[model samples]
Target: MDWLLNADTNGEKFLVMLAAVGLFVVVMGAVLVAVDRPRWVPQWLVVLGFIGPAVLMLVFGLVYPGLRTAYESFFDRNGENFIGFDNYVRVFTQDEFQIVLRNTAIWVLLVPVAATFIGLVYAVLVDRTRFEAAAKALIFLPMAISMVGASIIWKFIYEYKPDQPGVNQIGLANQVLVWLGLEPYQFVITAPWNTFFLIVVMIWIQAGFAMTVLSAAIKAIPDDIIEAARLDGVGGVRMFRYVTIPVIRPALVVVVTTIAITTLKVFDIVRTMTGGQFSTSVVANEFYTQAFTRFNFGLGASMAVLLFVLVIPIVVYNIRQMRLSEDIR
Candidate 1:
């Protein structure tokens, strides 16, 4: 019992994880055995057996928490007194929050587009190259590392040193400048540019995902379509532009929209690198600051709701594009 409440230790967390797995297995096994031993379980009950646990998990995990957060968004900081819409209004109109929104906008705009484009080009270049396997693996390695780990690695690479003579520069960025006979620069201390550097780290991590998804999509393109294009004298950049991109257009949209949603909710890179300071705070980081750091639960709830609202349109667009692409096929 104490172990359940004390999850700070790795052992306790592992134990709790095991208990959860054990509970799930027991419940599922009982359900299976009961269903099998029954005289004649109805078809609806069989279907329910398959979906019931998932529905229960969702109702308890997502639906209730989402509704509660929405409700709390209209209340005051402490959630005691009702303060309708004040938190929401402040989130939209306040100067500090505006900066957060601005950073979030930059992330959503840049991460998806840049990552997807770079990935598309890389995928095409290495599709059947001599060193295709090795090249793709090297590019995709970052995705295997967690975002927090990637941020830490890049942060070390972007490390800054005072431009003092006779001092060896430790950070790679500074070291490069030193090699070029220029003074070492502060990568994280600089304002908006620092945010861009953080964005680059995200791009590096997400480019692999985009590349993998887009590569599969490209491979799934029909062999006849590509041959027909070549027969019609379409090759090189023109073929890629007209044929390859169009054929994989649905996947492109899904990848972009998926990355956009991921970027909108990005927190780890910013948190690990900048701690949301110096105008680098985005909506996700701001939400954490409000909810946990500042103990402003209501305001945090509003920000969460705003994030949810922001993702809806992109998701809807992705669904529409996917359906339209299917219709075209």
Candidate 2:
């Protein structure tokens, strides 16, 4: 019994050990029951008994914590005081908060459209090429990298150095400017523009994902329609305009809306690269900074709630798009 609350073990470690011991006990008890051949219980009951633990685990682990966070959102920094609309009001009325909202809007708007457009073009061009797989793999490689890792890589790409003669430009963008005989620009440190630059990283990563989805959609188009279009002298751009675009509309909608949702929740790229500085903060990153960094739980909750509210329209649109897809099928 003393081992259950041992002095050498922290609460986390104790809980972990207890879980392991409980698992062992359950396994052994199950084996014993099997050996004894108890006929009173049905086989389905035994199977469900095994599954019950996993269901309970999810309810405790995921459902509980999310509910707890929602409850805390109405509370103050220490989660003691109740300040309902004040935090939410500050989110809209405050200049800095407005900037965060504006940046978030830019990210949600630009990243999805730009990424989807690029992906659609790339998918159409590469669909029947001899090097299609290689081209797609090259494009889709970014999606393989996590957002945090991609942000670090792009941070170096947008890196800046002082205008001093001795130090070389660290950022690839600045290096390119130097090569083109233009002055090196401070990318991350620049206001407003820096937010767009961060968005470029997300676009770069998500373009691959959009490409994969749209490319599959393109391939699923009937050969008969393409042939009919070509026979009608719609060979190149006109063929794509008349044939491919309409055929893959459902997939395009899914890609665009999925990327929009992802862009709305973007935090790692902003957090890792800019640390929410230089007015480059978006709703997701600002929520973390306000709630965790500044310990202003109420303000952070309001920001999160705002984000949730914004995403609802997109989600509804996505659902409608999915229903249309099912009808088409």
Candidate 3:
């Protein structure tokens, strides 16, 4: 038991993993055997046999952690004293956390809208074009890269060096400025606008995802609806505004809300590029910085809860939109 608990060695860790897998297999096997005896076992017991483990896992993993974090938010930094919303008050009122909230708002506002727009336009333009696959592949390439990898790639693009006589600009963006005979600016370290620069990376990565989803949605639009619109003299932008937009509205909402949720939880890009410095921190990264780096458990838990609360409304609205769309169909 001690060895299982403290598995420092590679062999011990592998053994522990095997033990867990074996235990899972044994438990599942027992459940299946019990369920297979339909005549001997009650129907409810058979249903429970299938669902009990999953329910237990969900309760242990999600519900308990969420409730625990919410409870912890009401305590002090050390988590020893009950502070009762003080941490949440600091989150809303403090200048530093105000900046964090502002940055998060900016991220949620811009990334989804900008990414979805670009994707929709791209999808529309390249819908049936000759270079459609190639163009889509080029745009979707960024989605294949991990967030940390994408951040590193963009960090190099925005890399800054002193404008010395001997120095050459390695960053593509800085090089463009140099070519234009303008001095290279600090892209990441500069406050406020630096946040926008970081946001661009997320947009670049998510634009591909938005395009993929919206493209499929566009393709799913009935040809007869488009034919009817064309016969009615609707063309170009007007056709898109009326026929295309209305047809894909549900998909558009899903894409936007999905991206917004992702944007709200954006941490890797900001953490990798700015480390939450220079007013570039969002709620997710700020939570990590508070709980882990700064060791302020109360504040961290509060931010976590705040993020959860913020996401709930968007999620509920997304679900409602999806259901409404389904009902209409």
lDDT tens string, model 1, 1-329? 88887788898899999999999899999887767745599877877788888999999999999999999999999999999899989998999989899889999999999999999999999998899889999989998898899999999998987777678888888899989988888888798788899999999999999999999998899999999999999999999999999889888999999999999998998899989998899999999999999999999999999999999999999999988988986
lDDT sort, best first: 3, 1, 2
> How far off is residue 5 in model 2, in Å?
12
- Angstrom error at residue 153, model 2: 1.2
TM-score, every prediction: 0.93, 0.85, 0.93
Judged by whole-model lDDT over C-alpha atoms, candidate 3 comes out at: 0.95
Over 4 Å off in model 1, which ranges? Answer: 7-20, 38-45
User: In angstroms, how far off is 223's CA in candidate 3?
Assistant: 1.4
Backbone clash pairs for candidate 2 read: none
**Model 2 agreement with the true structure over 235-265: per-residue lDDT tens digits:** 8888888898988998899999999998999
Q: What's model 2's overall lDDT?
A: 0.87
Best by lDDT: 3
Worst 10 residues of 1 by lDDT: 30-39
Residue 299 accuracy (lDDT) in model 1? 99
Better of 1 and 3 by lDDT: 3
Residue-level lDDT tens digits of model 3 in 1-329: 88789999999999999999999899899889879986898899998998999999999999999999999999998999998989988998999989999999999999999999999999999999999999999999998898999999999999998999999999999999999999999999988799999999999999999999999999999989999989999999999999999999999999999999999988999899989989899999999999999999999999999999999999999999999999998
